[model samples]
Target: MMDVLIETRGLTRNYGEICALKPLDLRVNNGEWLSIMGHSGSGKSTLLNLLGGLDRPSDGFIRVGGEDLRVLSEDGMARYRREFVGIIFQQHHLIPYLTAVENIMMAQYFHSVPDEAEARTALERVGLGHRLKNRPGELSGGEQQRVCIARAIINSPRLLLGDEPTGNLDHGSTRVVMELLSELRAEEQFTIIMVTHNHEVAAWGDRTIYLDDGVMVREELKGD
Candidate 1:
């Protein structure tokens, strides 16, 4: 049986007079790596935000792991984000002063209790064991992204969302980040939904969906 991890029906989002996402249906299976691709203002990030609980849809239904997102209260949504979703952004939103491990521990603090040892292990899994004490300012672009990945996965979320996570990286760094994500996904068995404009980045996913003007225009399977 196919384990559907995420599903949306007639999902829509609006900003006053502007509709950011049109009524659309989507389904993602457990442990699937799904990539969203589009030009700016095409509603890729808007869809991601709706899925991650960062933003609510204007109308329609979204369900993840059997929970309906539209009915969740603010606190309920917060809890859902903490327990079910992990997100990475292009900006690497780490505190400038905190060390890599400290940043990871901070995420744990929000999800439950902070454990330094577990945080250390998370960083180590991303091949950053030697750079635990380095702050974001001290790390290279790729290393900083690795720290972000470590932090995102620290809470053991069921769904991982990335918004142009490799947008700021060079080719080498991008490859490293994607490879690390692939390895971690295999081990952790979490579903991934990533938004990216880069074709190379989108190609790494098992499937890709293209959005244009808030509508899903087309989709491609891995080899198609």
Candidate 2:
């Protein structure tokens, strides 16, 4: 039997009077790679935030791994983000002064305790073993993103969320990042929900859903 890791019903989100996401339902199976694609102002990031528990829905239900997100308190949501979700954004968001390994260790510091050994392992897993001591300013865009990936997986989260993770990368860099993510997902068995405007990036996932004006207009199976 297939395991359902995330489910939403009539999910909606609004900012002031603007509806960012309309009433919709979504289901994501365990370990599935689901991509969300849309043009600007199409609610792609809003949906990703809601799923990551970084933002709450204005109405309806959202459940991940059997936990209903709507009912979580602020602290509860923080805990959920720390323990269950790992996120990567278009911006590296690294401390300019911190070394690659330190940046990853910082993520660990928030989750529980910072462990240098584990942080090093995470960086190594992302193929950054040789660049551990380099600060964000010293690394290339792709290398900086690799550090972010290491930091994201350092917590061993059950779900990974990416908001235009490869948006700033060149074609070669994007390929490297996506390939690394695929390998990491296979080893960790985590579900991935990524938002991207690029069709090539969306095609990396098993399925892609397209949103328009806050509504899901259509979806396509990867190989169909």
Candidate 3:
């Protein structure tokens, strides 16, 4: 039996009078790779933010691993994010002043105790063992992104959320990053929900869902 890791009912989000996301009902199975595709204002990021507990839904409930997000306080949501969701943003939000290893250790610091050994292991897992002392400015786009990936997964989050993670990479770098993510997922068995505008990138997932004007317009399984 497939375990449903994430489920949403009547999920909606609004900013002022603008509805960023229409009522959505989504179910994500454990260990599934789900891709979201949309145009500029299609609420793709909004959905991801909600799922990561970075933003609260205006209405409805999000249940992940049996915990109801709607009922969580701000601190509770923070704890939820630290314990369950790992987000990789398009910008590779690493502190420019910090070295690759330190950027990862920052995540560990926020989670609880910061362990240099574990941080080093995570960076090495992302193939950055030799670049640990390098700062973001010293790293290439792909290397910086690898640092971001290492930081995201340092806490061992159950769900990995990627918001245009490969948006800034070249073809070769994109392939490397995607393959790294796939390898990590295979070993970790975490669910992944990635938002991308490129169909080729979206095709990497097990299934794809397209959104338009805050509504889910289509969904396609990989083999279909």
lDDT of 3 by residue, 23-75 (tens): 99999999999999999999999999999999999998899888899999999
Prediction RMSDs, each to the true structure: 0.7, 0.8, 0.8
| Arranged by lDDT, best first | 1, 2, 3
Native-referenced Cα lDDT, model 2: 0.95
| Location of the lowest summed lDDT over 10 successive residues in candidate 2 | 89-98
- After TM-score superposition, what is the CA distance of residue 164 in candidate 3 from its true location, in Å? 0.3
TM-score of each model, paired residue for residue: 0.98, 0.98, 0.98
Model 1: worst 10 consecutive residues (lDDT sum) = 140-149
TM-score of 3: 0.98
lDDT per residue for candidate 1 within 83-124, as digits (tens), equals 999998899899999999999999999999999999999999
- Pull out the clashing pairs in model 1: none
Q: Rate the local accuracy (lDDT) of all candidates.
A: 0.96, 0.95, 0.95
Tens-digit per-residue lDDT, 37-72, candidate 2: 999999999999999999999999999999999999
List the candidate 1 regions with Cα displacement exceeding 4 Å: none
